[model samples]
Target: MKGTISHRDSFLAHIQQQLGKSSSKPASIRRPVWKHRVNWETNEGLSKEELVEQLKVQCQQIHTRVVETTPKEAPSTLRLLMKEYGEGPVMTSSDRRFAQYECHPMFQALQKEGISVTSWNADTSREENIRQAEQAKYAVVFSDYTLAESGTVVLSSHQGQGRALHFLPMMYIVCIEKSTIVPRMIHAASALHRLVEEGEQTKGAIHFISGPSNSADIEMNLVVGVHGPVRAVYVLIDDE
Candidate 1:
């Protein structure tokens, strides 16, 4: 019996025929751009005491151009950034799937503040879980990575994890591990590609959020919360 030619295979073969033996041709070559790599780390794998010293050196370098700011100032700025999109406080949950991030210091602190902390763990009932999300002022999530250039938070959803947590909330507090901060999109894609190569299953949704939910739809009035989070706070956790 003869098998049918699939549409995908046919399309690929057609394209290959059209572009055959064209590897040597250069298409309007553009000049290459140059960029200097910043050796942001201080010492190469220093000892404990030396590591502390290296940290001080790196801090000094970062502080040179950056303005002096207080810890209180940062949280306040974060809150203000959230409010820009008409968001309020926050509600958080510990997703068992992301156990690595469930123990974040910010998560504990937020819970202590009595901000309706719940969990989607096996122990919690379905009814309770839905109630918590519906009543949440805002859902704060912990991200696996943050892109500094675009100031984006990367959140991945897993089994028993509702994609709603990233959306339903009026505001989101994304705690990003500092080690995962990368300079560019290519770097981020490379990291994800490596994960796939290692046989890890990537989820259907990987959210990269930058700033609060916004829209300039009606007369460019800049309305917030058209699709997702009205506010996003990037908590750079020192993962050292």
Candidate 2:
């Protein structure tokens, strides 16, 4: 046995004896309680609108653009953004919200106009999905939740949406419904916990993307999009 220790019980007993512990069993330790609960209280008194505002302010610091629009105007708003970002080939997650928000038709319309739009197909092979995502100029996805404090978008990945969709694209566009905005990460965690408590299986991957990937080298020169999208945009729809 490569990893098995000879006389494991005796080795443990020798260590325990050196530590002056009479009992062979390890003692249980109590978890510590911190005095400050600032994380849970930072945005406690904010209204929905105020949270959205906070998210917008935070987005500025992260170098991400935030656009506000109504559900009725969402399609047009997205179209304009796509045009601004240099119209397709675009890759989009197979999130049902696209149809629910009536933006699916716009994708079809863009395709008809010769702007390539690729939707993540659940039936396709993983390699095929990656290939499509790699060739795309932009990736569009509906965020599962938006955290106001850090300006992060939460993406829960399933069969329809994979991890590559968020990382491979040159530009990322996140469609956020106003009602999905929360004060902070704590609320998002609680919501996921409740889903588990209610017997719902959560997705395997949950990505918290604050903005386009950025990093600094030893020289301290900041670089954007080193590992992900070069540009990021959040289109907030007033769905409520």
Give the best candidate by TM-score: 2
Model 1 C-alpha lDDT per residue in residues 66-150, reported as the tens digit of each score = 1112333434443444456444445554554235543445444656765445554436665666666666666756666655445
TM-score of each: 0.56, 0.85
User: Per-model C-alpha lDDT, please?
Assistant: 0.55, 0.91
Model 1 residue 105 CA deviation (Å) reads: 9.5
The candidate that achieves the highest lDDT relative to the unseen native structure: 2
After superposing candidate 2 on the true structure, give the runs of residues whose Cα lies further than 4 Å from its correct spot. 1-36
Shift in Å, residue 181, candidate 1 = 0.7
The TM-score, computed over Cα atoms with residue i paired to residue i, of candidate 2 is: 0.85
Model 1 alpha-carbon drift over 4 Å, by segment: 1-115, 121-131
Model 2 agreement with the true structure over 214-240: per-residue lDDT tens digits: 999748988999988999999999988
Q: Name the lDDT of candidate 2.
A: 0.91
